[model samples]
Target: MADSEDSTTPPAVSWRAILRGTGALPPAKKTGGAPSDPALQLWRNWQANHTQVVALTRQWQRIETQLIHSVGFPQVTIRLSGEEEPKIAHSVDEIEELLADEPEAERETLIAAFDAQQKRWDEAAATLGFDAVDAELRAALDKESDFTASVPTTKAASLPGIAAKLSIVIQLGEPSPKDTEFPWPELRSALADLARLASPEAAISPL
Candidate 1:
């Protein structure tokens, strides 16, 4: 009878009970409320979109200034001489005829002419400092190769008629005067138009 009572007794409580007693359950999380102002939200979005453009413009200006300081006026010159003259053995038709006839002698002459011409061109390129100029140009181009354009990311659906209106504003900014060969004045006018288009209200309520 004593053995049966011991067998009926329950096992010890689990460690999971200790966890529950220690308040191990995750704390309740708080959710944020929706943004209050639609206009402010649009402005914030526009600012974010234009941030990259602003950075790129600054970088471009810096690069331009650096180039101006590094190199003033750039020019390339080439020189040619008779002693190193390029060989000219045959016309295009003559080569074609030689090829058709399978003439070994003519082929050898053509090969020699090609080699001489290549040598002359090489000499000319060296005399003009072509390699150095090319290197400098390449380095300058690399320095100025930050080509980035900023674009707004708000879906078109969010701003139904805004893009078309903005385009019109951009066009109006470039008003041309009669008989002007260049469009500098028109471009200046375009800036004014853009300013008007990008009015505070339009920026806030782009829709």
Candidate 2:
């Protein structure tokens, strides 16, 4: 009788079957075609732009570090009115205030000096394919600006995840070398690895 009652009862619903029935399956596989959903496409575009931005940011960081380590700063001589030139104030705050007051005079001079140094640094970077990086970053920035204008300002949790992934990728691609701290070699190797991952042809391209 018990066996008969048990047999009469319907089989329990499988959790996996329930999930599949409820449309809870993993996302449909991408086939390299244009995304159908507008939101998804926007997210994808934002992801690509963010990747380039992060890469450029890392490259710029390396360049700035190298610059600071290699080039000695010019001794700033601030002529103070109080007495004895105020020991040639080197604090950024002091310089900022000084330049702020004399917009046409000291500000212009400071700007010109910065522009000259920036130009030289940019030129040096260009020689090392850094200019292309800047262009890529600019393009990414333009895309970001467009996306920002279009999207409603919402505190979406999605962006922070993508940003974090980008940060990790950049960090992994440019690991610090041991002993000798200079990472130019490591950075170049990492870039090559990234290029290879991006395209098989790049992996075998003649260096």
Q: Which candidate number has the best lDDT? A: 2
**Candidate 2 RMSD to the real structure:** 17.3
How many residue pairs in model 2 have overlapping backbones? 0
Write one digit per residue (lDDT tens) for candidate 1, span 1-207: 112221211111211111111111111121254223232233334333334344555555555455445442122111223335433333444444434555676566565655565465455555545455555555544432321111233222222123322332233233432224455445434433433343323222111
What local distance difference test score does each model get? 0.34, 0.44
TM-score of candidate 2 on Cα atoms, chains taken together? 0.40
User: What C-alpha lDDT does candidate 2 achieve relative to the native structure?
Assistant: 0.44
What does candidate 1 score on TM?
Answer: 0.27
lDDT of 1: 0.34
Identify the runs in model 2 with alpha carbons over 4 angstroms from their true place: 1-34, 72-75, 83-131, 153-207
Residue 126, candidate 1: Cα error in Å is 1.3
- Every model's TM-score: 0.27, 0.40
Q: Which candidate is the best by TM-score?
A: 2
Tens-digit lDDT track for model 2 on 1-207?
Answer: 112211211112211211112111112123455322333344445556666777788986776576556542333455646556443433445466765655467755655555565566656665667567667778877876776554443222332222222323333334442223455454434434433343344232211
